[model samples]
Target: MTDDLIGKQIGGYAILGLIGRGGMAAVYRAHQVSMNRSVAVKVLPRQFIDDLTYMQRFNREVQIAAQLEHRSIVPVHDYGESDGQPYIVMRYMAGGSVDDMLNAGPLRLDQIVQICAQIAPALDYAHGKSVLHRDLKPSNILLDDIGDAYLTDFGIARILGEAPGSTITTDGAVGTPSYMSPEQAQGHPLDHRTDIYALGVSLFEMATARRPFEGDTPYGVAVMHVTTPPPSPRLYNESIPVSVEQVILKALNKRREDRYDSAAALAAALRTAVEAPQASPPPDPQPSAPPPIEIQPLAERPIPAPVYPAPSAPSLRQVPPASVPKRKRRPFRLNLWVGAMIGGVLGCALLTVVVGIGLLIVGTSTSEVGPGETPTATADVTPSAHARALVNETAAAVESATPRTPTRRATAITNTPVERSGPSGTVIFFAQRPITVDGAPVEAYNLYSL
Candidate 1:
């Protein structure tokens, strides 16, 4: 991990040479014996190897960082300890860091956009995993031989929901003061936006070739970040568009809340502003109405009455009218009166049968000529013509069966079913002189019947 490890072997990786050394860790180009591929090896400094608390946290954070799999993020190959030192192996990027590029010359606007495009989404992906790259700067963005960029050094990033460890100490400021967010400078609680603010500072530096705020010491610089507003990037680079300047300032806003919510958003804003600097400002919050049309006043131009189309003259049909369908004739049916007559004939036959049956029943009975025998009627029970006619008329009424009106009639003087309670005796009356009943006339009657 130190300078002496140039020719030494640590955990099957042969240290080729030191790549760079930051405050947290030292990166070295190493040869992987098992895979036979060149890889970048990042080792923890010896100063932190003795601190057991930091060692445990470092391993935990690196393990989480290894789980990240993204095209833009530098993929972790392996991580383990050699003796008392922990080291992480990752893809070896050949094309130096943006730090080197900046040191050589000012970056082109398109180059800055291209680099941001690659890293912004990677930062957002880390944030989604609740891992914040507390240290996001030019030095951490690695480029390849072809100028393609990738985000690296994620092993030193702090987990969002966890407490501050030795990697990002809570007692003092966390990241480099040049790119540190205002909240990070003040040692305040941080969220994903802290990384966004640092990105803005980096953007300012890339555009202007200088940090937004500088002081005599790191503490002084951090305080300046907290207290002072960042000078415009255009102040150093007059060629920078105002829209691009606005995006940087917005990301570098003193309040974390005022910054972009996601790294992707910041990159997109920068891309849009830089690409379309001459484009019109965004439309107002309210919906845009159509351009107004001018109309002449009614006083100067009198309203013309609407003219209606003239009606065409009536004309005869071009073709003769289709012939109306003729109504079909129905077959003949029996008249209702004929049905009534047939019904009447049937009813008369039924009545004649009934009358004949009654007469036959009467004729069949023997006349005993006394009460001990039978009702010896002196007259024969013959079906008389008049009686037959009356029965036929009564049978006619059976068709409709309508109720009849009340009529008075004389009661026959024989065989009334009277209730007899006491003694029954015969009473004979001769011309109003024999027996008196009800204190009036003369009549013969059974006493019980009376």
Candidate 2:
């Protein structure tokens, strides 16, 4: 269908122009004539409404995001059908997206930390509610005018308590490959930690000004993510501290067990890294010169009889060398160093065998005890009940410690067609400069710059 609706009214709202479009839908900045308020309306493409699968997913995005209300999450104001098209009306955010900021290159450490502080909370809240955002990337995060972070596009978020492995089985490989976690890339079921992995990828990209893996094609990049270890972020910017590197690595761990157990853990570690003493960059290695080449002299040659004087000198020289050769010096001492070196090697081998036997005996004794070894007063042990209580307490602390972000306010709303750039690019809600609050004339269209 052509986007020729410059001044068409639907559901009492007038559509001005196209604001932005993605693979699934387009966002439009529109004016609600009845309420005299502006709003951002996301509508599914008309072509896919007939396809049951795409339609179901489109409906799911609205249903899932609409139920949750958070400052970081774009609030869905309404959901309905207009002229055979399903659309969602959400609060229009004016600040832009994180992806836009990252396009400028690596962000300062402080900026990265601040962004994480804002997004981590949203992730934690979603996880708490048993929702896993299968797609968590910079493009999906928005920053308001106050520089606060908000997560948008929960189209692929999976709500827990449905079925076993509901997260992956419900939808196969549904996220952008560059930011997908290894498990998600493999189409395996995911948990809270999976989102943590994607967030780590985003943080890495933010700090390095590039994605961890990139190739000729999306599939190639997906393979890299699954197989390659991320390059050191410090390589791009030496100012990145070691503590931050450790935090990033922990979250990017290939195995879920090795990653931060929860978003709060990652957020806490990030805060600590930010507060910890900064480390000095390592000194560059000194360049070395090429080695010198050895030279050899040509063998001496005897002169011909034609040179009478040269022949006499050669005869005298030969006489002196022969006299010296006759008196070959006897060796001052036998080569005893070789024998000493061999003796030392033998002694080391003997010592190694003795240590091996000792270690074997200790291992056997430990196994026989079957963890029943009594502890001396030096070793403190808790009773089974106390140990269980400690375990429960630790679990509760982990659950409680996950980080979350506070909600922020949006300055303007758009429901017309848009041109979405990287998420953080400056967004204009209207077609022209200076958005009108009294509702610009229905015919006076303004383009929103984002």
Candidate 3:
């Protein structure tokens, strides 16, 4: 049916929306009016309704699909023809299909195997019923919300015991090209092995996110199925074990005899590979010298006669000898010279600290010096900055004065006068004399009191 039947109600089932549409039929999400339960109703497309070949095939699919009663196979509740359109109603799967999962990227090995395991049994059941599903790809495998895998679309399946040339349509290729088995690609008679091969392609795509034989055209891919060997799935994903790859490759063999006998056989192999204990390969042999073995001369070695100890001898408890006491070592000798040097350094540091403290006290103490008693001025007075400049200038003048007497030395004691010019600031000084101390040598020193 076209999109018109989407909102239309049929036989107590209200068509809610269209989930998907294909070449032969369109699947719609509908609500069962009687039970108010939601289900997916697959009706033949409007374009294929008038085609007798397609109608017969669609009706046969419903009958065959209804026969499959496995958990992984979608359950067919009812089938009927309304307004000359044949439809098959099936249980709705909320989780969509494997094709949706593959749209993003390849799934992990465990996930692929798990999905495959569920679908494999369904295929095995249908194959036992002599129904060969021509289209067994990711899109045809539905996953429910509970992680259950369901096989769908028996529309193009070939019911066994029927004439080989009596298929619905024989002019063109029947199933999806990317997932077709070698026999299907060659347009030869197909068996359950064909389904196994298709399932292998599906598993390969799940593991690699791409088909085994991909081409720009369908014809080119069909040619690959007949000619080329598919690359190992592990090449795309290194996480896949070699055993898994072997199983996938065995199923994907170009020849029917090379593939597994049935989907059950393939599923068993996969389960074994998944559950079987992994074994490490044998190590390579190494060439080396043999070990040296000791040998004794029989003539030189004496054989000892067996001797038994007396049974009456009783063992006595013995005390262990006392442990030897550890001796004390003498203390290290201290060097007197080093001690003296250290003491001298410490004494010097103390003296310097004491002198600094005394100088600080002398500078700060006002009562230590008699303030009323002014010190008498003496000839040996402290040198001021001005006086120092005068002394330098006088030295230069004296040197110039005695230019002819270079060898003679002159010593003079006099007050050097200094006259300086500044920015309107008068230079004044309070003069003071330096008095001789008892132990200090007489010398000119600065007196801050001035």
Evaluate all candidate structures by whole-model CA lDDT and list the values in order. Answer: 0.73, 0.70, 0.73
lDDT of candidate 3?
0.73
- CA error at residue 403 for candidate 1, angstroms: 99
Global local distance difference test of model 1: 0.73
TM-score per prediction, in order, is: 0.59, 0.59, 0.60
RMSD of each: 26.6, 58.7, 24.0
Q: What is the lDDT of residue 377 in candidate 1?
A: 31
Each prediction's total of clashing residue pairs, residues at least 3 apart in sequence or on different chains, is: 0, 37, 1
Ranking by lDDT: 1, 3, 2
- lDDT tens string, model 2, 1-450? 678655776676788777678778888888877778877788888789898777877888877887677777878887888898888887766667788888788887888888888788888888888888888988888777788888888887888778754433266776889988988888887788889999999988888888878899989988887889888878877888877877887788888988888877777788778786454221234566588876545565544478454444344444434444467665343234643464455446534643453454345445555465652221222323533444345334432432221322222544464443322222223222222212221112232221
Clashing pairs in 1: none
Misplaced by over 4 Å in model 2 are: 164-169, 278-450
What is the lDDT for 230 in model 2?
A: 81
Instruction: Tell me which residue pairs clash in candidate 3.
Output: 378-433
Give lDDT tens digits, candidate 3, residues 269-345.
77677667264211234576689986779888778999998788656977889999989875443355654564465
